[model samples]
Target: MKRSSRKQLQNRRAIWMSIIVLTGMVWSLYKLSASLTLASASLPLTELAVSPGKNHAAPQNGTSRYKILIDPGHGGKDPGAAGASGKQEKAYTLALSKKVFDQLRQDPVFEVVMTRTDDTFVELEGRAQIANELDADAFISIHGNTYKDPDVSGTETFYYADDSFVLAQKVHEQLVKSTGFKDRGVKKEGWKVLRDSKHPAVFLEVGYLTNRNNETDMLSEAHQIRTAQAIANGIKNYFARF
Candidate 1:
């Protein structure tokens, strides 16, 4: 009821009001900062700021290019078919596949990958899985053929999927022309590699090891080189359409 007492009470009230306002503003600022942090963490990796000196440009059309997977059939424990002279199918396939790999690597447009670079045995399904995992544009499986009759001698290519027919045709054409072998032509077959492959795939029975002539030519270094070139050219021709 005293005037001095009323003034002192009003001053205390003013100080408490000021404190309450300041506390609310601090809490509001803290919530805003926490929300901003959460938003930043939720952003996708591609949307994040890249480190300095690093290039993280937006993906350009057609810049990713094509990836090709070359698989040499059989290896290590699996000798595959054997010629009369004891030359194994695994050896020939590896030799030829390496040459093909080298040829494709020389071209900038193609990115080449191999299933097995050495004498290692890769499971049948695993070979196809590799191509699928890498998202290969094409899968070319190199192999040699065998038959009960030695007279069965020729070059043949097989495809399981409709999308692979064109690829098989292109490669088979070059194979027959380059190797000077009888054109067995391209045929459809549900080979594991061809069947399991997500992309276009071809299984090449290059020649019959049972045939004396076919085996001899396949064993030659010169023949292998030319055949590799033919295979690489065939792949290039197939990709040129797209």
Candidate 2:
């Protein structure tokens, strides 16, 4: 072989090796970042005492409707996570909540109350207060996930209360099954709303907005409906186990 050809071959191999090394380093950094993200965020706060109030629901089949509080995480000026192009986590949560509320309202067994029906911000403390005031049977807060590593994607459920574990498990299962997203599983978080909620409460990190595929799927109307139905089923299933 010619010396010139050998030199060219050596240069090609060096470039390829450099690319391989760079890719490996980037991937290792991403894995470490993702592990840190999950590890750093799990904590749960104790419950609060709030005043009680009336629920507007007529009895059906000798049973009154279960008051369910549906909270869409962040709204108004607070766009929770801007992890995708032209997509805000707050918007996704609101959209999903609306669909969930719609599904629940159709059932005479549930009296659903929304934290915010439109684009608005309700204080985190106020959200918990509302649920407590109604003496809600269950409280579900909807949210989207975000991570520094855009590839990290899944459905994660969180709860601070003991009674809320089943709620989280049931909801998380249905969400994972319906969405086909990776299951991050049920976790514990000291988020103000769930921590302070007087009744069984759970927070759902529905899908990761940082991931392009997950974000794209989350934005779809069909996917949103499917997610809503799964959640509604979970809520019903949770109550049945009592």
Candidate 3:
């Protein structure tokens, strides 16, 4: 072969080799990027599974600082309020109550007990009796409020007689602070559960079940969880002062 022709062929071969090498590098880069993206996608889920509270601090006195008696108001024969979409207030209240119970159970400071865990009727007096018998540190009655006027919306907290005012104020304030809901102010009311219970007790009317918008908000699991956490935080903050 002529030297020039041989040289040209060699140059062509080198060009092809360079093209192959460049293509492989591009493919490797793509694979590495994809792996990195997959790893990032899995990080949040892995972190959540490893230690849920690593992202956010756990409650200060979880399940140990005091005994909290949780009462889910209205079940069985009483179907509380019927929402526009046929959602029952009784069921919603129980669901929220259970969420609150679960959140409180995480803390070491609380020895938590619920008056009823299922869709069964627990009488008003029966609830207070359980708290009294247990000699609980605090009693919280979970409930949803109803109003004929759908416009009447917001959260209201009530204390029996006078002894529970501080707890009522703390919980109500924390709820509003956490949720940005309308503050309906803490007030005094005669409730069988609060009145008969020896422990400091408060009845929480979380929101208006009769209002369609409010009911929708209350029905969300996220909202329920936040409300529960807010109440738990309020309890923690209250005791922190001690």
TM-score, per-candidate, Cα-based: 0.74, 0.73, 0.72
Candidate 1 segments exceeding 4 Å error: 1-64
Off by over 4 Å in 2: 1-63
Judging by lDDT, tell me the better candidate of 2 and 3.
Answer: 2
Lowest lDDT sum, 10 consecutive residues, model 1, at 51-60
Report the C-alpha displacement of residue 41, candidate 1, in angstroms. Answer: 51
Instruction: Evaluate all candidate structures by whole-model CA lDDT and list the values in order.
Output: 0.88, 0.86, 0.82
User: Which candidate do you rate higher for lDDT, 1 or 3?
Assistant: 1
Report the Cα lDDT for residue 50, model 3: 67
Per model, state how many residue pairs clash: 0, 1, 13
Which lDDT tens digits does candidate 3 get at residues 2-59?
Answer: 9999999999999999999999999999999999999999998887676532211233
RMSD of each: 15.9, 22.6, 13.1
Q: Which consecutive 10 residues in model 3 have the weakest lDDT in total?
A: 52-61
Candidate 1 vs candidate 3, TM-score winner: 1
- Over 36-149, each residue of candidate 2 has an lDDT whose tens digit, in order, gives 877665322111122122122223245667889999999998889986676888888999999999999998878899999888988888999999887788889999889899
Give the C-alpha lDDT of model 2: 0.86
| Alpha-carbon lDDT of model 3 | 0.82
TM-score of 2: 0.73
